[model samples]
Target: MGALLRGLVGLILSSVLVTSALAATAPVGGYTVVKAYPHDTAAFTEGLFYRDGFIFESTGLKGRSFIRKWNLETGVSEQERIVDSRYFGEGVVDWKNRLYALTWTDEIGIIYDIDSFERIGEFSYPGEGWALTRDDKRIMMSDGTSFIRFLDPETLKETGRIEVTDHGVPVRNLNELEWVKGELLANVWQTTRIARIDIKTGNVVGWIELAGLLKDAGVTGTQDDVLNGIAYDAVSDRLFVTGKLWPKLYEIKLAPAN
Candidate 1:
């Protein structure tokens, strides 16, 4: 009887250690809306970023996909450029005075003059383009899969990639991306949570739960109106988010999970 009890205790200790290890791998987070600004309800926002006091956005849907520069306070477009009808826009980012826009399933991306919104050129890639973001040197892209690809800023060619994993499991369906403070923040498609990824290791270190953000703004749209779009203003240290067809853009501040 004494030996049996000792074995049971050892088993229980092993279970506890396993549970604690899993908990340590997955960190959770939340957010509070600091402010809300009106957004165009017609926009199917796929990519968003802040620069030079303007919110640069790319809206999707074939024949409706376009890029625009928006006024941050009023959500009004100061400049716009319509994409070709044959392409479906996916994501966009700005680098070195140029704006790059990606197309879903088209295997192509567009480059434009940031100030003039004029199409400068186009580049080709291999897979579907789900989202785009950039750090100082490399452009990062997602393809609705578990992988994030790093591309050359000047040549717009694939340089490297990493498969995103959460606690030894692959995390797929990675959507809109934004590089924030050395971490890659991604909106997983069809979910209310955002994954905060370690760029070097490709591990999901934390998740930012954004539940009820759109609903609180009275956005009761369909599944197509799911959460998307993340824009970070490095200068002001402000983070902004919006959804497809959402009427309000929220400025959020992160709160650590309990």
Candidate 2:
């Protein structure tokens, strides 16, 4: 009887895995890449933000992490500052005239003067950091999991969190976030999708698949080069997407599914 019960449980687990694979393989809605810009190959871009008519980007990896200011028109890094080899910096955001950056495993975040890149203060977090975004009121953070938390902009204290899901199941591996038009745009690591999630109710409202974009860009990679970075131009309201170590960042527009 025990053997039979074990067999039944194994069957159920296999069924669940199969169902999840199918759901992930389902055809995506509609998306088109409008423009592609050459991104520096040396930068494993972690954090990307648009401010004051230029792009501010941060790169990851121990012994090589750096925050730099890039000229959007020329794609040239004008100024940069590297972090110590011990810290693997992840997400970054500009808040209240300061720049806040999260570390990979130290469970600490650092604040810096936006113009000078000088460290001002540090705070603690519960888990490893993955991505950061803001909605004018609070800072949104992800820790390579389905849950996204809102932090107090001034104190960096957690105020609330939501477990992102699709059809009542946890959506794992959520990374690299951007808040645009009251929606959360997330890059699901190792996948060809950037999911648009609703913050209030934890529902995945839609997704934009990057199959065509990757194919066009000649991105041939097994894992790390999957869809990752996302930034939106607030003044123009245009969306941009890219990957880790990716050669190009594409400006895109979403179309209704046919």
Candidate 3:
């Protein structure tokens, strides 16, 4: 069943403080909040994306895992489907009108019909699943490591992988993902940094340092409640970010670091 000992796993993985020297050489930047939207404080958001005027999210935790469709105007989830209790839900993404979701230790991936939220199929993978994002043809997955695995959308099987490196050092703890422009943006777990990576070369091209964002928005949280979610609206050119258990989501624009 791929049961994981939460405590032991936490102790090993929660020390996500490793920072590569390569990150020090990359261009860093900050954010400018264009708008703030209400967010469910109870959501431990693991995956996020925008589509058809709605925000789709995947929330984690063993018993509380769920995939929900959110109203950006109201910040309330209009519909949700719970994950099986045995799984700790992780990242989610949409491809060809179908939604794909991953579970942390269960090695399981669930596929659902976007309109009906009906479970249609399942696939398995080795190791853990941290987050998912897609371009036009393929799905990219992160497994809490330096590498991003590429999967064939048709077969949902691994096609290739690229190890993210800053300068030359491997950068780990990549979590939530989003594809913006032509680069892959990855949220480095437990930190306020988002690495903009070159997909083909796996080079960390730049970094978005988002420190003090929650405080600027007056949202409070402990160590575990961290910056973890990111979504983008390609049509409107809007970028959104939020955190685990955060009470607000911010639509932001990137401001190059001075």
Candidate 4:
């Protein structure tokens, strides 16, 4: 009888330890806004990236979709390409001196010359294009689902994919992706939190909470105004974030949450 009781206790302790370990590995990180920059309030920002002191952004809206290169300091578009009025633009990324821009619901992506903003080529995919980013070898794409697809940058052909999860549960509505260091940082639609995902495993290793970032920046808007853009400057190690229809952009530093 005593042996049976000891075995039961041991099982319970092991279960508890496993649960605690999982919780410890999945941390919710906080952010401190280091600076605020002017962003075009009329722009419904869908994708953003930093390169060579310029911010390349994609805006979405049926007739207003555009790919723009903005001066980081002044928020002025140095070059812009307005897409066809019938197509809605989505996410964008820079690879091999070319800018790739996706179109929502159209299943088409356009590639442009980074310097001249001229259309060089375009590719067709299967589903909606919600977000885009790239690593050293492959381009990462999302379609408002839990899955992230890997594509060959040269061919724009899907090479592989993985379903993203948080603590073994699927994470949907993944949007606005940026490759930071080695991890893929994705904005969760309709929420202020960004998921830090493992590109190889598709597991969310951590969450960056931007809960009060907009409010602290004195941004006022309706519920439709959700956080949606992420840009990282690898050279400076600076992180920038903004939202749909947001008036300001913020440069933030992440810290471990208590």
Candidate 5:
């Protein structure tokens, strides 16, 4: 009887913890979602970057990999280039006057000139590529795991890596990335929450539950179509969000959850 009682108590405690984690919510200090729509529905949007009012996007899938740019205002592809069918394009970032891109499961990252999307060279990685983002100094990458790797932009070498953790647990499946202010904004795949992560310690400072944001937009459905894309426009201080195969991208200003 004692053993059974202990097991039941443990289950009850676990349920409480799960509910608490989901209940801990905070107001977004200063975030406004940018309402923007892409001209085309990208099949697999692996990586996204912005420069000079144009978006540099990388799409996945072995035979359908590509790097392209779209006009921000018109949402029209101004230029596009294709990669070989053997590799899947992943995250993309800007380093100096060049653009760096990664490939899924290929362990190779491609580099190109920023002005012209031309493959200048390639570099090797230790794991599969998932997403890429950068700040003023280091290049940050995710590999579909709990860890985020930092690389040297000039050398493309693993300088160091930080494992993302929620409380004391590893947070896996971190996908699609954007560097906002000094923090790394990560889209936790398959969930309606985006974690604001501190890059130095892998600690999740806070999480923004996007359920209200989506429901407000009338995209009601299951959690399968939850949050995915994250992009920040520093110029206007606007945050843009969307999901996989989503018909429209919304620009929203997050009102703090009081």
Candidate 6:
């Protein structure tokens, strides 16, 4: 059921598409697993990020959508909340102690108190919301398109847009995002690649490829098991990644692609 919705939404998103060939403008990199943690395999991870000592993730697919607050060590949700059935939930991020969650197709975003997970407010946007992340001054959102929208935290209104490209060609299907170091890392939906984008120039500076992490973790499944989530822990400087219905979440150290 969830997989079917995923396929339909994917078709809709891919109707107007861009060729994802990075060519030579970006260098492809690899990874070495630093550590592994448990993740709920049932989660259709659409957004993920690390805050304080926990992982905050949002899952999609109509009635199954959720905002999970996970304890990093045990890979367990210490607290959880279900999104309204009408909305398919997407990305999630934290700003000034507020947790912001986006719903796909519905164009609505929900806000909650970071500590208590209490709903504080909701806002509407113009299109499909796929993923979200943040920089110091603004909230960054992806809408299953090539452009990344910047929203002012207080106003929740779009301030600007960055057309993510690789050598001038638009890169579509920019899924779950994270502000890692100073770069915006975006998942190329249903692929084993992450685009390291330069927000200033809107160019992909590099591509991080993890071809076999799923297989090595014994996460064999259909295309639904693709690489689709990323979360960076700044304080610990650790990078964590997972996928849809994947049992293991990996903390990986970046290395050159072999």
What TM-score would each prediction reach against the true structure? Answer: 0.90, 0.89, 0.90, 0.88, 0.83, 0.89
Q: Per-residue alpha-carbon lDDT of model 4 for 1-258, expressed as tens digits? A: 999999999999999877865565467899888998989887889999998999999999999989989988898889999988988999999997899999999999999999988999999999899999998899999999999999999899999999988777788999999999899999999888899998789989999988787776566434657899999999999999999888789999999864
lDDT of 1 by residue, 96-179 (tens): 989999999989999999999999999999989999999999999999999999999999999999999888678899999999
- Tens digit of per-residue lDDT, candidate 6, span 1-258: 999999999987765453434344577899899989988988999999998888999998999999999998898789898989998999999899899999988779999988888899999999899999998989899998899999998889999998998887888999999999999999989788999999998999889988779787576545677788999999989999999888889999999743
Candidate 5: where is the Cα deviation over 4 Å? 1-34, 212-226
Q: Predictions ranked by lDDT, top down?
A: 1, 3, 4, 6, 2, 5
TM-score of 2: 0.89
Please state every model's RMSD to the true fold in angstroms. 4.9, 2.8, 9.1, 5.0, 3.5, 9.2
Model 5 clash count equals 4
3 or 5, greater by TM-score: 3
In model 2, the Cα lDDT at residue 122 comes to 92
Quantify all predictions' global Cα lDDT against the true fold: 0.92, 0.83, 0.91, 0.90, 0.78, 0.89
Find the candidate with the highest lDDT and give its number. 1
Clashing pairs in 2: none
**What is candidate 2's lDDT per residue for 77-150, written digit by digit as tens?**
87787877899988888997899898888999988898888888899998899889998899999999889999
Q: After TM-score superposition, what is the CA distance of residue 23 in candidate 6 from its true location, in Å?
A: 3.9
Clashing pairs in 6: none
- Which segments of model 4 are wrong by more than 4 Å? 1-25, 219-222
Please give, for residues 1-258, the per-residue lDDT of candidate 3 as tens digits: 235677767766644433434235688889888999989988999999999899999999999999999899898878899998999999999988689999998899999999889999999999999999999989999999999999999889999999999877888999999999999999999788899999999998989988768686565544667898999999999999999998888899999754
Q: lDDT tens string, model 5, 1-258?
A: 999999999999999998776565433343455465753455366777677787777777778888888776677788887887889888888888988888988889888887788888999987789889999889999998999999887898899999998775678999989999898989887777777898889988777777655664455536445556677788987777776555556666765643
Clashes of 4: 0
